[model samples]
Target chain A: MNLKVENVSYRLGKKVLLDNVSLSLQERERVAIIGPNGSGKSTLLRLICGLNKPTQGEVLLAGRCVHRYPRRRLAQSLAFVQQKANTEDIVRAEEAVSLGRTPWIKPFEAWSEYHQGFVEKALLQVDMQDKRHQYWHTLSGGEQQRLHIARALAQNTPFIVMDEPTNHLDIKQQLGVLSLIHHIERTMLVAVHDLNHAMRFDRVIVLKDGGVVAQGAPETLITEALIKEVFEVESRVIKSMGFASNVQLIA
Target chain B: MLVKGLQGVMKSHPLLFVLVSTLTLSVFIVLGVAIGETQIDFQTVVYAVANGALGTQYPINAIDQGVVWNYRLTRTLVAACCGSALAITGLVLQSLLRNALADPYLLGISAGASTGAVLVTIAGIGAGALSMSFGALIGAILAFMFVVALAALASGRRMGNISTQVILAGIAGSQLFNALTAFVIAKSANAEQARGIMFWLLGNLSGARWQEVAMAVPVLLFGLMIVLWHSRALDAFLFGSDAAASIGIAVKRVQVVLIFSTAMMTAVMVSMVGAIGFVGLVIPHAARFLFGSSHLVLVPACAVIGAVFLIVCDIGSRTVIPGQVLPIGVVTALIGAPCFALVLIRGQRK
Candidate 1:
């Protein structure tokens, strides 16, 4: 499903978080949203996932107003993986993943074979099949984040809006997560902090002060001038080994 | 291989364990009917129950049948229902609030019921017409409404931002109702009224009646249905508000419905059988330990185990000493406090 945000604005009390921002995503697109701290990247993703209503203007999913869609219907199209890794201590990994099927199952019906297959696939996709029986609190930070991603995958939605999927991962785990996202065929809107990983995405949307500053193909949009303008950093983007981009500070 | 082993354990043990526990509970219920202050023999009690329920051609006296089935059996059922309802309510509230300490009475239901029971005892109003259970029901509903209103006021007329505010409102309302109960008790006109009020406050199932059971069962069943219907939503809540909303749960609406339904069920149960404590506070955690944290299993497990626990406690209260029945609440607290302490200790070790 394609998502279109038109002139969307949001305010928290008196402060504006997102201001009249507009963006669009084509089907099966992998778009990275990158911004400096407190630049409303997470807020924008929340708005897209229907967790927060826009203060003004509209978000359309395939030409219909996003709010008009029933909550389950919207959830069936898009799932959200949050930045917070830990849930309650009692939740098992498999039970946590099974929650993704909640929007589809009616009350009192036993989980069907299709739901089981989806959970199995999700656990396999995140490579957490071995840890499926572990308590949520017992998992390591990166493993918990992967489990969160698995939960989103178990929803079997075509699109996923992720808020910092690699927030606390070590270098190796971060690459593993980014590589997993890159290899997946579904549309993903991810808020990422690392420019190198963002560069590998099909598209990047740069935000400054709650509004879109620049958006285009990663190669064209992520220039030295834009980095200095938006991020206040002096940086170099180098084409590195294995077709992956590497970013470094020049100063 | 490990997964298969775990699955085998779950399949082989938990269901059989719950089944055995349920059977033991039914036996306790039957035993409870037989061993009371009246000193009826086992065969006579069985004959009485059969005569009362099935109208069998048994040579049972009318008075014994009435005492066994109409009075003792009804009280037992009411106690079981109240225990099950409160435990299930605790399960739902803990899951909803994401707090281990939340219970059925967390919304000021008990204090409200206490206040109403106290008021009736002090004023001597409706002494001939209204039962203490009715007074408790009124008090519980009022207290529940007051808390809801306080929450609404704190949240500026919206149920948003309810995570901490509802609990705070409940605490404030509890204090308010407790003070009111104390004041009413202090100004009572007679010593007998004070004793009655005190007994009600301490919690008892001595006066349970068929009429009370008739009122309590449907409310308890309704509350159970509400919790079961929203078990998935409760699971979503454990992920916190944003993730829950992202998954298409109407968090605020579900919270309101759950709280109101739980409070209503609690009021009915408390009215029917004074203010039994600790069953709600400890049984859900007990259920969690036995059957993982899935609400699908947790809710029913808590209900069943809670019923059995209370039935056994009531049996101990009645039969532990010959001819003297202890307050049901005291027995539960005696049992639950140590269990709660153990859970906390274990949690700290973890």
Candidate 2:
């Protein structure tokens, strides 16, 4: 199902965090929401996933308001990987990943092999199968991020939303994660700070001051003028052969 | 050797794991009934149980039967229920609040219950109309509400560090209620009344009749059911409430229902058995250590371990001084304090 965020605005006290922001994601499409700090990128994602109710307008999934759906049902359709979201450091990685199956499991039901298969597959996808028994605190920040992604994968939703998923990852791990994202057929809405990473997405939506400044195919939308206007930085969009355009920042 | 064997069972057969745990709990309960001022053999203890449960004559001595069936059995059963209830409450609180130090009493329930009990015993608030348990329950609920309100107030302005804010509010509320309890006793109680209240406050199971069992069992079962039903949601909270919500959990509703239900269960336990500390704080950690952090395993494991641990503590309380019985709370604290310190030290090392 396609995900829709329609004219959504979120306010905390007198400060408007998200201002009438609207966006949509087609099924199996990968989109990146890129913005400068304090541009309401995270807030927009939260609203879309029904983590926060929009003060104005509504988020619709498959023609129904997102918040109107039952939490478990909504969860089965959309999984979320949050930025800096952590639990008790003592939880084992495998146990943490298996929790993604919460929406599907019923009371008194045993954990079936089917659920275990998903968990194992997710772990393998993130190359975290070896560290599945490790305590969360024992893992590095990058490892933790991968485990978080594995959890969302194990959820096996049609749509997966993420906030700064590649934040703590190294260059190689970042590319690896992006590659994994590319291979996954699920619809993805990722909030990314790295313009280069945003360029790699199928489409990019640039947010500036809580509203979308530009959104389209990255080739057309992510240009020097858009970057200078939205990010207030001088950058050259270097087109490459059979690859996503790389953003080279002017020093 | 036994621990390893049990682990093997737990890994391979879940039904066997439950049966073994139940058997372990029964053995501890039987031991609790057998060892006391007057030593009763295991056979007599079993006979007393059979008579009580199966309505068999059993040909047991009258005094032995009376002591075993009426007094020791009820006390041990009540202790088991109280232990499991507190442990489950602690586990829930730790998960939902995302604080390692979170316990059943952290939200001021125990302190409030003590104040309520003191009010009834000293100030004559109900004037013989209300029982101490009822008063304690009232005080507990009121204290929990106060903590909730304080937490809400603190969280209203900023959406940052809610778990820490709630923990701070809990500390503040506990201090306030504890002070109130102290103030009431100092202001109103005479020498004998003060001593009686003190004894009760330190935890006494002398009053654990069948009625207490009837009260505690259902509450424990209900609370366990509520927790078990939402075990998946609890597991989802591994990464905090926001993460739980993103995964389709009704975070607010789940949090409210869980905290409220666990708090109520904790209050009931405290009202029945005073503030038996440590079991709530320690058992869940031990369970998590033995079994991983899955609530599916941890909940039942904590319940069983907590129940057995309390029964052992009760036995220690009964037999430690030879002729005199120590307060179960004092015994638990004595044992619990060291174990708690060990938990802290181990946590630091890890």
Candidate 3:
């Protein structure tokens, strides 16, 4: 499904958090939203997931306004994995992953075989199938992050939106999860603080002061001039062997 | 082999766990009805039960019939209902607010009910036999509405509410109603009347009758069924409201229905058995170990475990005094605190 954000804005009290942000994303497209801290990446993701309303303008999924569909219908087509998604209770790993089937399962019914298969496949994808019975609080932070992604995958939606998807992850876990995310074959809109990770996306949308500063294929848009202007950081773009650009931030 | 088999069965079928717990409760219930001031024998009690089942076809003597059928039967059954109602209500509130300390009385409904009871007992608004119950129900609903309205106000621009803010508002609401109750007790009543009010506030179940039991049982069962129907939604809610909504659960609508149902059940239980404490606060946590916080399993576990807990406590209240009946609330707190300490110790050891 195609997602179109049409000049949407959101205000919190006296402060405007999203200012006329608009974008059109194609099916199976991998787009990255990157910016400094508090640059409205999380807010925009919230609006896209229908968890928050736009102060003005609109969001359309498959050319229909997103607000028109009920929340369940919207969830069937899309899933959102939030940054710092946490539960303080002692939930088993498999139980947490199975929660993604909630939109499909009825209140009185148990999880069907197909739903169970989804949970199994999701855990397999994240390589956490062996630890499915472990309690969530007992898992390492990186393992928990991987489990959270598996939960999002278990939703079985065509599109997945993530905010700071690799937070609390070690480098190996980060690379592994990102590799898994790349091959999951879903339309993805991921917000990240890592400029290097953003550079690997098909498109990078750089945000500053609650508006899009630049957006395009990373090779074309992520210039040293643009980095200094948007990030307020002095940096050199290193040409790496397999990466589009390796950003080395400098003081 | 036997222990493993038992464990497997318990794990696979949650209903079997509920069945076993209910069997335990049934034993306590029998004891509750049989052992009174006069200490009726078990066979005699069984005969009375069978006679009642047969509509008194083989009638027992009138005095024994009155003791078993009228007094012990209603009060014991009512105590069980109170246990089931308050425990489930606490479980709902605890899950809804994501707070271990949240109980059925957190919404000020008990304090509201107390204020209403005070008005009837002292001011003579409706001085009939059942007016106290009626006034208490009205007060419970009113307090529920005020807490919800206040939560809505404090929740601010966020679509998903903050449970802590709602809880804080509830405490404020509770204090308001409690002060009103205290003022009425101080000014409008004599010393003897004040003493009775204190006993009522501390939850005495001596006035429980068949009429109150008839009203409470159906409401508790129906309310529990509705909660069971939405068990999956509540399980999703165990994480957080945002996570629940992300799974396409109607977070606000479900919260509203759950709050009202719990309040209604609490009102009915309180009208029959004053403001019984600790059963709601502690039983759900004890049941959580058996069922592991999934509402489908947890609800039934709470129902059975809470029933057994209350019936045992009621028996203690009766037997501790030779002829005098003890307040159910005092017994619940006095027994509950040490048990709660043990639960804490066990939890930490785990």
Candidate 4:
């Protein structure tokens, strides 16, 4: 496993944010975490990404305990993309993207041509080539989302973790971002609100009340009964759409 | 647009702009020395610098040397150092705290320093600049520690001080310290002593000497070097704390380093010359308007511009009325507040 979370638990004061969650990822594998709000998907991702410490167990990256790895080394191995990357800074789009090269650059050193290449290629991949010089705050919400993903892409880490990578994107841009993520050759652990996006993943982890309710290949774990049991909502899994099937949810 | 033009020039030759600005400040120093209460000639000022007192190019007087070197030169250098120190502190603090309004004084250092100064003067514990600066440094450290601890708690013990809690804590801390200083002065001092304490509270650069400059310059250089060394980590902080951490920055360590350096600089500066407002508050924003938020460019720009601003304000304070000195703190707020407003308006329009 390129990345492993073994029996991790987290408590925010008295609230058990996550309870004994375990998962593993192979090289270049894509896994989606699907759950309703307050189900610990984001918290689990946060723990795995080293943003928060787990109360129990540990996260291992590249066969080393994550806590033991130096911060820059950990950042070089994994990149995190958020749904919204908010900043008080009034900076150009290209400058914001260049921040991804920070782990590679040393203190007081300028970003090299090699670093700029990564940023340029990522922007091009996101189709934000023309908006490179534009102010980040002025960009549309969808554009901003793409730019942030591009920032993660620029990091060129082997493991990528995202929380709602498709939020704020239009339909075309949504698919575009997914296709972009899909085409990238990396291990992806994504928390996705859209079940359609999750179904396309190689595997899915279903979360409920801060516990792992089910985990399997999406086709097996994503049955209507499980959805009904967890979300308390009726859902129908229609066939013929492959893993990208329409999982219709009714109120 | 004026700033845009300057930025365009800066984009191509940032070194040249910084050098030229430094050169401009050097000329301002000479002018500041030359055009004091006595209004000596530029030629004589140059002669005093180049040829010394005994055997000059043109018969220079002892009074001229005394006024130029003993008074103006020392104050000018202090102003330059103060400006650079406060401006760079503001730049680093704003980035570290992720607050646009963060400045050297925002952490309660200035208020605490004032309290220390008042205590010393009223109780007659220590006289002279050295002991006064020592007292102020002690007071500043106390306030800085308290505010930082409060901010850290408010941020849920997170390593970074970027939370709104730090700012709120600082505001409270400043009010408490400022009130304590005021109460000490009002209650303890006789009329003459109170007047003197009041003058110091309004900010003062009078009686500036080479010793004060000697004390401030090394710390100023040290602070600048440390900030320059941590420029990349500081850039990481431009994004919120979580993002900075995700990128592998030791955010807690960086925040502690930044807090210490800025507080140290502010303590030294405020102790030497009272808490001159607005340089730390507004200069970084003005520098940002010219150069984007990249600290590599922004920090240098702030240093140069901030020096020029304080020196210019110093000149105004010197010449505003015939021999009646005005507190520099007054002029900086009077000027810096409007400049900051203009920057906000222009930014919004852009």
Candidate 5:
């Protein structure tokens, strides 16, 4: 699925959060939004996911206005995995993942076989097949994030939006989550804080004060001058093995 | 593997356990009619109930018939219905709000009913025996609507943040209603009227009648069906709003429907039998502990356990003092408080 943000802007009370931000993601594109704190990175993702409406412009998914689509229909096309992990009840991981099939279920009907298959496949994708029976409260932070990702995957949507997907993860789990995203066939738009992690994306979008400052292939846009201007840091971008771009912050 | 394990556990206890429990409760319900100050014999009670229902050729005294058939039997059935209704309402609300502490009374139904009953008493508006129950019903429904409206306003018509606000509003509403009730009772010139008001406030099934049962049974059944139909949505809500909404569940609509229906049931039950406490609050937790949190098991189990608990409490109320018929509400609190404390302690240990 292709996502097009056409001149989107948002304001909260007296503060303008996003200003004329327009971008697009083609099919199977892995894109990262990188910026300093309060640069509207998370807000941009929320707008794209239709959780918050833009003040001035609109978001289009496959050439249809997202706001005009029914909520269930929109949900069927795009899934969002939020940053929060605290749940009020003790639910099994499988039960949580099965919720991804809500758009396909009718009132008073049992879950169908296709929904079950999707949940199973999604769990297996995250390597959480063994933990399907475990309580969500018993899992580690990284495991819970992975479980949430699996739930998003189970939605069977071609597009996935994540906000700060690596917030509380350690270095190894961080790499694991990014690697899983890299291997998935779906189009992904992730808001990330780490430049090195953002370097692994097919495209990088640098934002400043809610406007798109630069966007293109990661190697072309993640320059030392861009880092100093957008992130207030002196950095070097190096070419590494496995077609990976590595970043080292200069002191 | 876990599914098979759960199935095995359920199979081991099938309908046989429910049948045994139901049989024991029926015996207790029948035995409850035999007690009371009249000292009616077991045979007389049985003959009275059968003759009352079937017009059998059994010789039964008029006074015994009035006490057993007209009074004790109706009260017992009302107690059972009220208990079942409140427990089911609590289960639905708890699941809807995703809060274990959510109960029918916690949403201001009891307070509203109490306020309505007190207003009717003070104004002498149709001060007949049945008017008090009617007034309570109106008050409960009004209070329920007020709390819902307040919660909706606070949450921007969203269901996720309404639970805590609804509870707080209920507390405020209860206090306001209690103060009004107290003011009315203070101004009463007749000491007998004061005593009647006190008894009603404390809650009793002593004045139970066939008319009350006629009103309660249908509401209970309707409420049961509504809760059961929304059971899957309730399960989704337990995972949280985003999770539920992500799954295509309309969380707000389900919350509104469940709250209003449960409140309607609560109002009718409270008006008929006064404000019986603790059954709604405690029975769902007990049901969850016995059967897991799955609504398929928890909801029906809550109804059964709630009915049995109140029946046993009603029996205790009659037999414990011999001559004096204790208020069923007081008995339930006395019995339920200690058990609730035990559960709390156990939960902490866990």
Candidate 6:
């Protein structure tokens, strides 16, 4: 499914949160959205996921307005992993992951092995299969974040939208999650804070002051100039380990 | 022992678990009917019910049969309905609002009902035309509307975290209504009338009758069905409303419908039985501790456990003080407060 945000603007009272922000994604594409704080990255993700409506424009999926379809139908094709989602409910790791099957299951439908298969696969993907029976509160912050990603993965949607899925992870787990996203046969739109990590995605969209400043292939768009302009930091882009481009912030 | 035994049954066979729960409710209802002020035997209570329900010609005292069939049975059934409805409301509110302390009375329904009943009884607001229950129902609806409006006003532009605003508004509305009730009673009521109104406010089932049973059961059933139908959506709310919406739930629609339904069910139960406390606040947590947090299991578990808990409490109210029957609310609080503390302590340890 192709996801398109056409001239979306969200305003809260007199303050403009997102102004005329637009982007489009092709099927099986991996796009990273990077922005300074208060640049509306989370707002854009919420709009695209249909958790909130765009004030002036609309988000469309496969040529239909995203809000036109029933929430269940929309969710069957697009999964969302929220940033820093937490719950007070006492749920096991596997039980929490099983909720990803919600869009697929009817109200009284029996949870068949087919559904359970996705939960197991998701747990394995996040490397939390060993802790499937553990309580959610017992998990560390990074592990909790992984479970959130695993929940999105278990939804089995073609388009997955996540906000800072790697926020709390250490370097090893961060790379593991990124690599997993890279290899998956799904279209992914992820908001990331790490400019270095953002450089690896197939495409990058940079936002500053509620609008898209630049977007395109990582190599072409993420030059030293764009980083300094958008992020307000002196930085250099260099070839790291032969095949990868790395961004190093200059002091 | 029962909680552990139930855990084992829940893990092994879902059908057997349901059967066991239903049996427990039935047993409690029978015990509630039998062991009242007049000690009707268990067989006699069952026979009286059969006679009343099926026209069975059982040779029993007319007074005993009448007491069992008309009074105790109706009281116990109404108590069960109130417990189930209140617990379901609590579970739904806690999950939807993401507040652990949410309960049926948190929306100010109980306080409103108390005020309304007081007005009708002492102030003679209805001039003997409106019954206390009807007045209470009206008050509950009015108080709920006030809370909703206050919550909306407080939240204003940012509707993101309205649940907290709602909790606050409910607190304010409850305090306001409770003050109104106190003021009215203090101003107008004589000692005898004040005493009666106070007893009713503390929760009384002395007035529960067949008519009440007829009213309460269907409301409970309807409320249960609505809640069970939305159990999946309720589970989605574990992570909050935004997460629930992202997972295909129509968060606003579900919230409005469930909240309205639970409120209506609670209003009816409160008017019928004077706002029995603790079942709503404690039973869901207890159920979650025994069963898992999945609403699919939690809903049924709460219904059964809540019914049994209230039935047992009703029995305690009748028999605890020898000749004089204590108010049902007092018994529940006397028992529930300690049990709730224990639940909190156990939860913290876990």
DockQ of each: 0.61, 0.73, 0.68, 0.80, 0.40, 0.82
lDDT of 6 by residue, A57-85 (tens): 99999999998989888889999988888
| Candidate 2, DockQ score (0 to 1) | 0.73
Model 3's CAPRI class? medium
| Model 6 regions lying over 4 Å from their true place | B1-12
- Residue A5 accuracy (lDDT) in model 3: 97
Q: TM-scores of the models, in the given order? A: 0.93, 0.94, 0.96, 0.95, 0.87, 0.96
| Winner by DockQ | 6
Best by lDDT: 6
Best by TM-score: 6
lDDT of 1 by residue, A1-251 (tens): 68999999998888999999999998889999999999999889978887778999889998888788888788888899998845554667888888888778777676678899999999999899999988888888888888888888888888888998999889999988988898778988999999988988999999989999999988778888889999998998776567756678787
Per-residue lDDT tens digits for candidate 5, residues B1-350, read 44335433543565765676578668767866786767889999999999999898688798898899999998888888888898998888777766788787887788888878877876575656558888999888888877777766776633456677777777777777777777777875278877776677667887778988887888888988888787766766655666566555655677778888888988988987788888998998777655655565567677777887887788888788877877778999999999988876764442
TM-score-best of 2 and 5: 2
Instruction: State the weakest 10-residue window (summed lDDT) of model 2 chain B.
Output: B1-10
lDDT of 3 at B341: 82
Fnat for every candidate: 0.54, 0.80, 0.54, 0.76, 0.29, 0.78
TM-score of chain B of each: 0.90, 0.93, 0.94, 0.92, 0.90, 0.95
Q: State how far residue B52 of model 3 sits from its true place (Å).
A: 2.6
* TM-score for predicted model 5 compared with the true structure: 0.87
Task: Write candidate 3's Cα lDDT for A66-129 as tens digits.
Answer: 7787777887888888787677665678888988888888877865789989999999999998
Per-residue lDDT for B3-119 in model 2, tens only? 335444565688887888889997898788888989788898889889988999999899988998899999999999999999999999998888888999999999999999999
Worst 10 residues of 3 chain B by lDDT: B1-10
Which regions of candidate 4 are displaced past 4 Å? A241-243, B1-18, B51-59, B126-130, B158-162
Give the candidate order by descending DockQ. Answer: 6, 4, 2, 3, 1, 5
- Evaluated on chain B only, candidate 3 has a TM-score of 0.94
